[model samples]
Target: MIKTKRLLLRRVRKEDWKAIQRIWKDETVSPYAQYDNIKELDDLSVTNRIARWGREAEYYNHIFFAVCLQDEIIGYISCNRCVDAYEIGYCFHSKYHGQGYAKESVLGVIAYLLIKIQMEKIFILMVEYLNYSLDGRGKCMKIEHVAMYVNDMEKARDFFVKYLDGKSNDGYHNVKTDFRSYFISFDDGARLEIMNKPDMADDEKALNRTGLIHIAFSVGSKERVDELTHSLSADGFEVVSGPRTTGDGYYESCIIAIEGNQIEITI
Candidate 1:
């Protein structure tokens, strides 16, 4: 256990799962986490997680420390030994953010690793500011998927698959409400959920709508952008804007696709 001015850093116990669950469920915290199965966490899974942490600590010297403030677990820090240094990752309850608790706890862990454990170096992993590895090698917070209501789910699914090169699932249907949906996945691990339901409102989308104006996709280069813009235009999709560089220097084009929704293709 390590103590700071107002916090306690200790080895996590099985009972700490509830506190950890609350942290994981926080909207501000979970999306940035690499725990794709967080929503499925329960007694069994959390207990197994704790047990796995124990095994990791024992077998590989990897450590997970629960951060406590005033006798309450508010966050955790994980230190995993990389090839040459320890990579540190952490998450705190959103309520405790900007309180310097994270800094203090990280300092405590760094001290323990460097002095007590006699480690050579430490690296702090920042998920928010970096493109995180998706090969199960590191933690990152990115848009898992975006869901949108569409009139024709299959048409939307085919549009993404044919033009955007998205691979879609078999699709899902609910017998009770006549609801259906498809999960379209892209090469970079991003996803789009197109859903449909009976009697869903088909509101006329205005030009200057307030909420969620568009979804932008990066196609890697100006040539690809031009090719896709021309392809989409050939397919009768209205080109709303240019394949020319914008004032901000984005080589892109805007189009009306997927049920009148705006899609931006950029380099």
Candidate 2:
């Protein structure tokens, strides 16, 4: 249970389903539902959903909480761990809107996650597909994908595919813009978006360039780092840095690709 100055956040109970249903049925709150249009749900449908939420204690290994004030349920909060961060969402009864209850309830839940649950970082994707900006959320940044221009899309694709074990998408092409690209996805949901134009020149990136310096891939172990360094070097890839501990205590090695792009393989 999470308690604030004016709110109590707790697990939803069978009895709270009625209030939850009312909150979901509100047009104001229903707009925030990502998976379904809860405004159209009848009492039976709401009851079943609430029952499912109650039965699924972990909520698919995440969490859902009820926000209460003065012993009356007023809102709900749910979170899911996506990739390297957590996505959080909250909704309240129309009557409770603009009372700071939503923010307070969200803060309480965040505290529970960071302090009690010991999460390293928390990120908020949203409750709905529509975008709504938050004030001073401090978690506005989450890298969706890293994009780069590659001189040789095929070689760049092959490098990531062979070394990082990346899975290639079907790739994209735009004849009008003369743009071609490929998306390489890693196991941990990180993606590299490499694009190219036919007339683009192959230039060596200098160390002092004022842009993205390098991209890093985590291999999970020092042994794997050494092995990959040797194997990549043998395959004629440029080995820039060491398979030794760095100043920041990372067991890593840096390699230069055929496109002259730097990549750091780390543990």
Candidate 3:
């Protein structure tokens, strides 16, 4: 059990399913939840589902905590194992919204995971419609740049500038470390930093490798996607995938560009 000033977070019990069901039934909470058949689930089904969650906790370390206030279960926070980190998700009763209980409980749980469990990383999972700002001052946050290590920084910078219409700044160089980089900016305010350093390991980028696989840019239309894709292919860059509509409806093409990195041009 993890306790904060006004909240208690403990491993969920099967008996707590009624409170969890009540929270899930809330109009405000149900829409964002993954379980679509909460309304159709009978008491037996809900209990079985809760038992499965408990089993997952015991077997896989994927834990679901019942967030309680004054001895009442008000909501739940789930922490699922993802690679080396934990991905967390939460929901609460609508009446308890905006009370800071969720925030307090999340902090307590995070502290417990990091300090007591010796966890290295924790990720918060949110719904697609929700905008989570990392800025503590209540200001809007945006990605300033995405950076990557490259062998030939100039070749990488030229690839972006020539094909993708990226504008490059006068590159930076560190005398002590022999490090160099260039910041290539796009018209839509996105920036990419291509960097180089001595003795940097160049691992073979397997097609199914994890981590960042590609950087995608929207070119405004399907026609533009086709046009640019043909242009890149004509210029000898390998077109790894088509300028075709994907299963998820993305009209895009993937190309092996800039030191074996994949770049996706989309509409």
Candidate 4:
């Protein structure tokens, strides 16, 4: 069992099915549940489902837990094996909303997964309409720039400026170590910093390696993606993939940059 100052999280028991059904029946909580417009389950159905959840011994497949406070069940959280990653979902009674109980219970479950079960790479599926106020500090924050090193800075700068319409600043030159850089700003505030060691002994492009696989840019629509892909192909840039819907629901096309780096243009 995982205990916080005001909450306790433990394995869901058969007796807790009534509280679980109550939470699922709540209209407010039902909408945010794993399944949309989920129908309310009866005592027997809930019991069967609870039995199907199995135990920590069968955690290789799935697991579910009840979130409680003062011996009263308030909500439930679950983690299911999704291919290679664990996908987690949580639902709380509407009356308990805005109390940070969900966060505490999730953290406790994560601790159990990592420390006891020794599981890694948990994926939290979020609602599409929700925006995360990540730090809870009421401060606006965003990605300023993504930086990378290239063999040919001028060629890379020209490719982005000419094709991607990225505005370039006066290139920066450092004499101490002969490092050089250029900042390419897009229509949005986001910028890309391309840098290189001008006087380095070894200058070879690293492709199909471990770090920094690709950089993706979101376009206006699918039409824009097609247009950009055609333009890049016509300009002799390698179009690796098509302007098609990806398995992850992205309408995108992949192209190789001047320095052999993969760039994804998506809608």
Report the C-alpha lDDT of model 2 over 66-124, residue by residue, as the tens digit.
99888788889877654445678777877887789988888898888888767777776
lDDT of 2 at 154: 92
- Residue 249 of model 1, lDDT score: 62
lDDT of 3 by residue, 53-133 (tens): 665444335679999898899889988665467888788887887789889999998898898878899999556433454
Between prediction 1 and prediction 4, which has the larger TM-score? Answer: 1
Summarize candidate 1's per-residue lDDT along 1-267 as a digit string, tens digits.
Answer: 899999999888767778887887783354444443334345665565566555444433467899999889999998866545788989888888788999999999999998987889999966553444454655654678999999878888999989987779899999999999999976536789999998899999876789999999876556678999999999999998999888766678999998889999985
Off by over 4 Å in 3: 1-134
Stretches of candidate 1 exceeding 4 Å from the true structure: 1-140
TM-score, every prediction: 0.50, 0.49, 0.50, 0.47
Task: Indicate the TM-score of model 1.
Answer: 0.50
lDDT of 3 at 157: 88
Candidate 4 has a TM-score of 0.47
* CA lDDT of each prediction against the hidden true structure: 0.80, 0.75, 0.79, 0.75
Assess the local accuracy of residue 69 in candidate 4 as a C-alpha lDDT between 0 and 100: 86
Candidates sorted on lDDT, descending = 1, 3, 2, 4
lDDT of 4 by residue, 176-203 (tens): 9889999997653568999999555554
